[model samples]
Target chain A: MRAVFWKELADYFGSWRFIIIFAVICLAALSATYTAAQTIRGDIAQTPTEYVFLRLFTTSGETLPSFIFFLSFFGPLIGIIFGFDVINSERSRGTLSRVLSQPLFRDSVINGKFLAGLTAIAIMLASIILVVSGLGLRMIGVAPAPGEVARIGVFFLISLLYVGFWLGLGILFSVLFRRTITSVLAAIAIWISLALFISMFAGIAANWVAPVDQHSEAEAILEHERIYDSVMRISPTTLFGEATETVLNPGKRTLRGVVLVREVEGMIPGPLALGQSLMLVWPHLVALIALILICFAVSYVRFMREEIRAT
Target chain B: MAPPVVETIKLTKDYDGTRAVDSLDLRIEEGEIFGFLGPNGAGKTTTILMLLGLTEPTLGVAKVCGHDATREPLKVKRITGYLPENVGFYEDLTARENLRYITRLNRIPERQASGKIDEVLEIVGLSEVADREVGRFSRGMKRRLGMADVLVKDPRLVFLDEPTAGIDPDGASQILDFIVSMSKEKGITVLLSSHLLHQVQKICDRVGIIVKGCMVAEGPVERLGREVVGGGQNALEVQVTESSANLIESIESIPGVKAVECSGDMLSIRGDKDVRAEVSRAIFENGSLPLHIRAQDYTLEEIYLKYFREE
Candidate 1:
C-alpha cells in the first residue's frame, strides 16, 4: 500500500497536468479576489467599513468568500479532470496490466490513486485558503478572529470532501468507460447537471410543482416553503456554501424574511443556530460521502473483475 | 520440487457468449522461454491477462509460481512481470522518473531503487535517455523503456505481449535477443506472444500456435516444421540438360516420391525418403544429365501459413 501510494504521489508531481491544475486554481482565486475587491471598492465605498468584509465573504448570499466559492466550483472540476483518466489511461498504456503483475494488490492501486488525488486537492485548497487569508488581512487591515479562522478551516475541509466526492465519481467513470474522453465528458456532464444546473432548476421546478396556496391554510404554505428550501439545497455545493455562510456570520437573516429579533418579549430559537445549521447540511455531507464510497467500491470491483486484454 | 513457473489446466475465457480462449492446458517450465504464436485475435493477450490475474477465466484454474491466479492474485502477481503490446509509459515523466515510480510500486528497497533504475536503463540501452520525457521517445524507445520497467523487478515469470510490435526491425531484433538472453542467463520463465512467426522461431525453445482461440499446434520449432512440411522431408528442385519426359515419369514412379512436377527443364520433387539416388540413376539411364539438384527445408513461414489456413 505504501509503495503504491508513494508511486502515485510521484506521478502526480511528475506529470505536467498536476502543475497546470495548480496554476489554474491559484490564478482563478487571485482573479476572483481582485475583481471582487475592485467592484466593492467602487460601488460600496459609502457603506460602513464592517460591511466590506461581509460583502467580500457573502455576495448577495449566493457566493461565499467569493474566492472560496470560486475554489469550490473549480476544485471538483480539477479533481474530476485529474482522476477521470487515472485507470483508463493506465489500461490504455498497458501499464495497468504491468503494475498488477507486481506484488501489489489491486486495492492498493485504486487506494493509492485516490489518496494522491485527495492530497492534490488538499494542497490546492490549502494554498487557496492561505492566499485568500493573506489577501483578506492585507486589504481589510485586520486579521480574522480565531473563531472565524476556525470556521474557514472547517469550510476548507468541506470543500476537500466535496472534491473527493467528484474524484470518486471520475474514477467510477474511468472504470466504466474505455476511452479517456468519454470518462472525462461523463464526469463534466454530471458536474454541470448536478452541481450547477440541477439545484437551480430544482428550486424553480419545486415552486411550479408545489405552488404556495395562501387561501388554503397558513400551515400548508409554510410546508410548501420548507419543501422548496429542502429541494433547492439538495445540491451538496449549495448546502455546504449556505452552511459556511451561516457558520461564519451568525447574525445573518434568511431570504424567507425570518430575522433574529433579540428584543422580542419571549424569544424562540431561530433556524440560524450553528448546530441547527450543521444539522440542516448534515444529510448532504452524508450523501456525498456515500456517493464517494459507492464509486470507489464499484471501481475497485470492476478493475479486479473486468477483463484487461488489449484491443 | 519447485512448481512450474506457470500452469493452466483447461483454462477458458468467454466474452459475450463467444469463447475467447477455450480449454487452454499449458505448462511453462521454469527457466524456459515459451513462445505463444497465433494470428490476429487468437486470444494470446487474453491468456496473458488471465495469467496476471487481470482477467478471470470462465472455467478451470491458472497458477503462477504455484499460486492460483484467481484466488491468490497478489501472490501470483508478486513474481510476474508483464509487458503488453503497444506498451505505454507515463509520457509526462522522464524515463528515470517512470522507472522510479514502478520500482516503488513493486516495493523495491528505497536504497536500491535508484541503482535498479540505472541498471535497467543500462540493460535496455536507455541510460543516456534516462532524463528525457517519455513523450519524446520513438515507438521502439518506448518499448525498450517498457522492457526496462519489467526487468527492474527481477520477476520470476515475465509475460511479454508482442514485445516487438511497432518497433523498428533493429529494435525488434534487440528485444527478441534480450528476451532470449534473460531466460537463458537469469532463469526467468518468459511467456512471449508474437504474431511474427520468424522471430518466435528464432528465440523460442517451444512454440504454441493458436488459431481462432484454439491451440492448433504446439511443439519444438523443428518438430512443428517437420509436422507441417510432412515429416522433415526436403523438397528438391532438379534441372536437367535434356527434356527427358520419361525421366520425370520414372522419378514420379519412385517408391518414396510424395510429389513430382516438371516445368521446362526443371523437375520439383517432394519425398519423405531421399529420392536423389534413384532420380539421378533414372536420368542417366534415360540419356539425360542432371544439371543441379537443390534440397530445401521448411521455414516457419510455411508452418505458420499451413496452421492459420485451417482457421
Candidate 2:
C-alpha cells in the first residue's frame, strides 16, 4: 500500500501533466486571492475580527469571484484529472496485472491509488489555504481569530470531499472505459454537466414539480424557488457551492434559502456561529462523501471482476 | 516427495456464455520450468490469472505454494511474481524507481529492498540503464525491467506470459537464458506461457499444450514429440554430397527399417524404431560422406499443429 501510494504520488508530482494542472490551479488560486484581498481591504465598514477573516474567502469585486467560488468551480478538475486515467493507463501499460501479482491484497492496488490521490489533493489544498492565509494576513493587516481558523479548516475538509466526489467519479469512468482518452472525455463531460447543465435540469424539474403558471400567486412563486433549490441540492456542485457559502459567509443563516419576508424576519445579521454553520452543511458534506464512496465501491467491483489480461 | 508447487483442481472460468478456461487439472513440481502453450483464445492467460487469483475461478480451486489461490490470494501473491505479456511500467519513472515501487507494494523495507532491487536489476542485465526513465527504453529493455520488477520480491515461483513475445532474437535468447538460470541456479519454479514453441521446447522441463481451453497433451518436449509424431516411427534425414548406389540399400538392410526414399541429395530413412545410429553407420560404410545426418524430432510447431488439428 505504501509502495503504490508513494509511487503514484511521485508520478503525480513528476509528470508534465502535473506541471500543467499545478499551473492552472495555482493561477486560479492566485487570481482569486488577489480579487478577494482587494475586496476585503477596500471595504469601508468596520469589520469584526472573525468576520474579517471570513471576508477574505467570501469577498468578491465587481469583476471577480471569491476564493471559495473559484474553488468550487475548478476543484473538480483536480479530481477528474487524478481519477480519469489511474487504473486504465496502468491496465493498458500492463502494470496493473504485475502490481496485483505481488504479495498484497487485490484491493491494495485501487485502495493505494485512491489513498495516494486523496493525500496529494489534501496536501495541495492545505498548501493553497496557507498561501491564501498568508495573503490575508498581509492584506488585512491582522491575524485571523481562532474561530475563523476553525471555520476555514472545516471548509477545507468540505472542499476535499467535494473534490474527492469527482475523483471517485473519474476513477469509475477509468474503470468503465477501456481507453484513457475516452475516460478523460467522459470525466470532462460529467464535470460540465454538473457545473452548468444540472442547474438547468433543476430549474426544469422545479417548474414541473411546482409549475409557474402565468397567474401564479406569490406563495406559488416561493414554492417554485424552494423546489428548484431542493432539486439543485442533489448535485455535488450545488452541495459544494452551498456548503462553502454557508461556512465562509457567517451571515448565511440557512441553506433552505428562505426568500419570503416572513421566513427572513427571525434571521440574525451576524455570521452564523461556527457550530450552527457546520450543522447547516453537515448533510451536504455527508452527501458529498457518500457520493465519493459509492463511486469507489463501484470501481472496485468492476476492476476486481474485469479479466486481468491484455485483451 | 514435496507437494507440487502449483496445483489446479478442475479449475474453470466462464465469461458470459463462453468458458474462457475450462476444467483444467495441472500439477507442477517445485523448481521445474513448466511451459504453457496454446493458440490465441486458448485459455493460457485466463488460467494464469486464475492461478494468481487476479481473477477468481468460477468453479474448483487453484493452489500455489500450498495456499488456495481464491481464498488466500495474498499468500499466493507473496511467493509469486508475474511478468505480463508486453509488460508496462510507469513510463515517467526510472527502471530502479519501478522496481522500488514493486518492493514497496510487496512491503519490503527500504534497507532490504534497495539491495534486492540492485540484485534483480543485475540479474536481468539492466543495471547499466537502471536510472533511465522507462518511456525512453526499447521494448527489449522494458521486458528486462519487467523481469527486474518481478524479481524484487525474490519469489519462489514466477509466471511469465510471453516474456519474449516481441523482442529481437538476441534479446529473446537472453530472456530464454535468464529463465533457464532462474530455474537451474536459483531453483525458482517458472510457469511461463509462450507462443514461441521452439524456445519453450529448448528450456522447459515439462510443458502442457492446451487447445481451446482443454489440456490436449502434457509431458517433456522429447516425449511429446515421440507421442505425437505419426505411426510411432522415427525418421532420419541424411544429406550426402556424393551419390552412392549402395547407400539406400545398406540403410534398408537394418531391422525395423520401413523404407529409404531418395530425392536429389536428400535421403529420407523411415523406421518403426530408433535407427539413426545404424543408418549413419550404414552411410559411412557405403563410402558416401553424410554431410548432415539428423534424427527428425518433430519441431514444437509440428507437434502443436498436430494436436490443434486433432482438437
Candidate 3:
C-alpha cells in the first residue's frame, strides 16, 4: 500500500499535466488575493477589523472573485483531474494485471491511489490558502485572532472534504469506464452539470415543485426555498459553497434564503463562535462526507469485483 | 517427486450467460516451464487470472504455491509473479523507479529494493538505461523491463502471458532464451501462456493445448506431437538410383515397417519407428543403390493445427 501511495504521489507531483494545473490554480489564487487585499485596503474604515483577515478570502475586487470562490469552483477540477484516469490508464497501459499480481491485496491499489490523491489535494490547497493568507495579512496590516485562525483552518478542512468528494467521483468513473477518455469525459460532464448547471436545474425543479409569484404566501415561498436547497445540495458544489461561505464569513448564520424578517428578529447580529459556525454547516459537512464515502465505496466494490485484463 | 507448484481442480468461470472456462484441471511441478498454448480467447488469460486470484472462478479451486488463490490470494501473490501480455511500465518513470514501486508493494525495504532493482536491471541488460524514462523505450525493451520487474521480487513461480507478443523475431528468441536461462539458473517454475506455438515450443518443458476452454492435450512437445499425429508413427523417404525386383519385398519385411511404396526413383516407407537404415541396407543388398534417406518429424505447428481443427 505504501509503495503504490508513494509512487502515485510522485507521479501526481511530477507529471506535466499536474504541474500545469497547479500553476494555473496558484496564479489564479494569488490574483484573487491581490484583488481582495485591494478591496480591504480601499474601504478600511467601512469594515470592522475583527474578522478582517477572513475578508481576504471572501472579498472580491473589481476584476477577480474571492479565494474561496475560486477554490469552490476549481476544487472539483483538481479532484477530477487527479482521479479520472487513475485506474483506466493502468488498464490501457496493460499494467493492471502486473500490479495486481504482486503481493498486495486488491484493495491496497485503490486505497493507496486514493490516499495519494487526497494528500496531493491537501498539500495544494493548504499551500495556496497559506500563501493567500500571508499576502492578505501583508496587505491589510493586521494579525489574525486565534479564533479567526481556527475558522480558517476549519474552512480548509471543509474544502479538503469537498474536493475529496469529487476525487471519489473521478475514481468511480475510472473504475466504471474502461477507456481513459471515456472516464474523463464522464467526470467532466458530471462536473459541468453540477457546478455550472445544477443550480439552474434546481431552480427549475423547485419552481415546478412549488410554484410562487407576488401573490404567494410566506409559507409558499419557504416551501419553494426548501425544495430548491434540497435539489441544490444534490451537487457537492452547492454544499461546499454553503459550507465555506458560512465558515469564512462567520457572521452568516443560515444556509437558506430569507423569507421573513421575523426569522432573524431575535437573532444576534454578530459573528458566531467557531463551534456555532461548525454547527450551522454540520449538515452540509455531513452531506459532503457522505458523498465522498459513497463514491469511494462504490468504486472500491467495483474495482474489487472487476475482472482485470491485460489489454 | 516434488509437490506441484500450481494445481487447479475443476476450475470454471462464466461471464453473463456464456462459460469462459470449463471444469478444467491442471497441475504443474516445480522447475518446469509449462506452456499454456491456445488460440485467442481460449481462456488462457482467464485461467491465469483465476490462478493469480485477480478474478474469482465460478466453480472450483485454483491453488498456487500451496495457497488457495481465491481464499488466500496475498500469500499466492507473494510467491508468484506475472508478466502480462504487452506488459506495461509507468511511461514517465525510469526503469528503476517503476521497479521500486513493485518492491515497495512487496514490502521490501528501500536499501534492499535498490539492490534488487540494480541486480534485475543488470540481468535484463537495462542497466545502461536504468534512469531513462520508459516512454522512450522500444517494445522489446519494455518487455525486458517487465522480465526484470518479475524477477525483482524473487518469486518462486512466474506466470508469463504472451511475454513475447509484439516483439521482433530476434527479440522474441532472445526473450525465450532468457526465460530458459532464468528457469535453469534460478529453478523458478514458469507457466507461460501464448497462442504462438513456435515461440514457446523450444523453452517449454511441457505444453497444454487448450481449445474452447478444454484441455485437448497435455505433455512434452514430442509426446503431444506423437499423440496427435497418431500412435508413434514415423514417415521416412528414400531415393535410389535404380529399382530392384525384390527391393520392395525386402523393405516391407523389415521389422516395424508398416508399408512401403516404390516410385520411379524414390521409396516412401511408413513405420512405427525409424527404419531408414534397414530400408537403405535392403535397397543396397537388392542391388539398388540408395542415395538419400530422411525422416519426417512433427513440429508444434502441426500439433496445434491438428487439435485446433478437431475442436
Which candidate number would show the highest lDDT if scored against the true structure? 3
Give one digit per residue, the lDDT tens place, for model 3 in A194-245.
Answer: 9889889889998999999999999999999999899989888889888988
Candidate 2 lDDT over residue span A217-257, tens digit each: 88889899888888888789999999998888888887765
Clashing pairs in 3: none
Report how far off residue B219 is in candidate 3 (Å). 1.5
In the range B18-52, model 1's lDDT, one tens digit per residue, is: 99999998888998888899877889988888888
lDDT of 2 by residue, B55-127 (tens): 8899988999888988898898889989888687878778988888888777899899999988999999988
Model 2 chain B is weakest, by summed lDDT over 10 consecutive residues, at B226-235
Better of 1 and 2 by lDDT: 2
Error of 2 at A162 (Å): 1.1
Q: Candidates' DockQ values?
A: 0.55, 0.72, 0.84
Candidate 3 CAPRI-style tier: high
Q: Model 1 Cα displacement at B112 (Å)?
A: 2.2
Shift in Å, residue B196, candidate 3: 2.4
lDDT of 3 at A12: 88
- Candidate 3 Cα misplacement greater than 4 A, ranges: B240-243, B273-277, B288-292
